[model samples]
Target: MRVHKFTFAALAVAAGLTLTACQSGEDGAAQGGASSAPPGSPAASAPASPGGGSSSGGTDQSGGKNSAGTGSDGKGTAAGAGSDGTGKAGKCRTGDLEITAIDSTVGGDSDGTVAVQLKNRGGQDCTLSEYAGVDLKTSAGSLSAKRTGEHPGPVVLKKGKAVSFGVTYPLNTSGGSGVRVTGLVVTPPDETKSVTLAWPGAATLPVTEGTGSPVKVGPIGSAGQGG
Candidate 1:
């Protein structure tokens, strides 16, 4: 009877120890199998990156969309990016151009055209587009000429290269005085600044203001084409 009691007590103790070991193993396994990020890991603490962490390649970001190579409006191309992949050549500024004006025909006495030239004086390449703004400085006043041709799309002006435009005007042929043009105030396309050039020859005859303005300007073209 004493041996039976001792054996039963030992069995009970062993079973209790085995059950406790199993429970401890299960608790440790549950903790080790957790999916949550550990403390101090990047996934636990890093803030969300913008644009879903997508690379933008330096494009513009607006309205939660990428508008690369497009201006702020998203409808126009970026300033330095051209459609034909003329990358990084910016629009020509007035200060970077050298302007000159000359009579298109030699020894003109009547209606004539003036070939106005613009040379890219800057060290880098630039672009020019649209009609050049031209004003004839006359004895009467500054006579602004009207544009006459379709806009020649943007033309790349390489360093030291040049382009030309045309300005047509009816000279005084009635043996009477007409508008006496003395000089020219010229502005490049899309430019706010202007340059002044002296008229090629002796002062023009005369057509006083108020009579009528027949002066016309044309688009830019090859250096000597007179537009």
Candidate 2:
């Protein structure tokens, strides 16, 4: 009886140890699974990247294409970069002009006869007539009310245009009037859209250089014969 009891006690002890080992193994597995979970998972700790959309000063963070923006260097960049900085671009068109004069001396005027040329350069027909008034200036001050002759009727110059006319008056030669042409302007008819005429610094009348003969003062331009 003693031997049987000893055997039974040994078996019971063995079974208990086996059960403990199995329980310990199960607990270890559960702990391992909890510790090794991916980040942000139910069993994890660290937070994920700053993703899903943080924002800036009203700028979207989704990296989408913007309507009024394209990630440029923040400058004045648009359609009309060189046209007028107005973000608009178009062709520069205008009517034509021609000027001429008669002088006795090269670079000098004895009889004081000056002529003008007119034409339509704006590819289309335009109405034009010599203005009947002029504005003169001198070092002393400005002088208005200069007497001018009656100009011809409004002439329509179609496309490639040219004309020559004359100005015969003994204009006073003194002060700034000697060399500087204070003003020479042209006005387009109200029907056409045109900018204010800015005549080049050319002499409205012919100017002579070395001799007493007269030379064309200005109207420096390019010929637009071919489009």
Candidate 3:
């Protein structure tokens, strides 16, 4: 009986040790499973970053806005750039031209005509249009010519080429005193300065009193041609 009791006790102790070892093995397996999960898994200890995805998306949208704003600024700068007037050789100035007057004749009740010639003395080509401003100066006063209704096209004056315009007036009228003109003052189209040329001794433009606008000026045209 004593030996049987001792064997029974030894068997009980071994069973207890086996049970403890099995429980410890189960706990170790649970801990290892928890540690082995990937960092991006749903059950991870770190909280989910909800803003991270939205922040990346917002950065892309902001990049588009920045590019659009830069494009608008570039277009605004381009729109503000004006034409530099290089096309069409620019308008002619008074200093780039030479002015002179030549005697001319008109038929049928018209007294006489004076062809005012304009020569391009500059190195570059220029444009001339419209009627030149003419003033007849005498010892009494000054008389301006009336601008005619003729509309001529723009005349491009190259170097050493000439253009002409005419002034027609009545020399003497019936039962009126004749007025004498001593000098002629000519101004180029769209110009402020003027040049004076002496009147020809043989060709005298006599303006009669009581005649409204005795002088009429024509538009600029080719040299020796009526506008």
Candidate 4:
């Protein structure tokens, strides 16, 4: 009976040692698997949060550079448009012109005609159109000419260029009493101011009262020659 009890105690001791060894081996294998994990593994990659910041920083830098480039281009385009002078220049003022008259003889019952010349003496270009308003003033009386139904084309005069028009009146061939004209008053197209030019003494402007003013005016044309 003593021998049997001793044998049972030894068997129990052996079984306890085997169980402890198996548990230690399993724990060591688990620790090794955790330590040897690759860097690309989900568990190992958790500390790569700074990589996301670097990616965002690169994108922001690119966007900022693109925005700056676009802004510079827009500014350059605006400046170019401003310098292009999209609006045209203004019309010429009355004070910037020169007016003159030349005596010309006409055919038929008409006595004579006066060629009025208008020159642009200003530094810029100008436009002139329609018939010139003309009135003959003398010591005897004042006589205004009737504008013809014909309309002249618009004439653009550059600096130092000129334009002209014609004025005609009937001759007093019957030797009746006629009014003598001393000076002529000319009003340019679209202008309110009047310019007075001295009539040439060589020519006479005969006017017959009550016969309806026989005076007639033509359209504006190229200067130095009448149209």
Model 1 stretches astray by more than 4 angstroms = 1-88, 106-110, 205-212, 222-227
* Candidate 4 per-residue lDDT over residues 1-227, each given as its tens digit: 99999999999999999999999889989787555568787556555355553232334454354333445446522222112253333355578878888876645534577788888888776777777788888666777888887765676667787778888776656665556778989888888999998985333445455756777888877224422
Clash pairs, model 4 backbone: none
Per-structure clash totals for the candidates? 5, 19, 0, 0
lDDT by residue (1-227, candidate 2, tens digit) is: 99999999999999999999999889989787556567776435543336743233355569875566543676543553334345432222333433322232325654344334445455444444433222233232333332233434444444466544333333344333354454443322232333322223334332224433232221211111211
In terms of TM-score, which candidate is stronger, 1 or 3? 1
24 in model 1: Cα distance from truth in Å?
33
Query: For model 3, what is the alpha-carbon lDDT of residue 30?
Result: 80
Order candidates by TM-score, high to low.
4, 1, 3, 2
Q: Which residue segments of model 4 deviate by more than 4 Å?
A: 1-89, 106-109, 201-204, 207-211, 222-227
Error of 4 at 153 (Å): 2.9
Task: Give the alpha carbon lDDT tens digit for every residue of 1-227 in model 1.
Answer: 99999999999999999999999889979888654688888665655468666343455656565445556676756544332355657888898888888777557446577889988888788878868898888887888888886766888788888889878777666677655778888989898899999887335744545655677888888325322
Please, what is the whole-model Cα lDDT of each candidate in the order they appear?
0.76, 0.41, 0.73, 0.70
Which pairs of residues collide in candidate 3?
Answer: none
Write the residue-wise lDDT of candidate 3 on 129-148 in tens digits.
78789888865578899988
Colliding pairs, model 1: 177-206, 178-206, 178-207, 179-206, 179-207
Which of 1 and 2 is ahead in TM-score?
Answer: 1
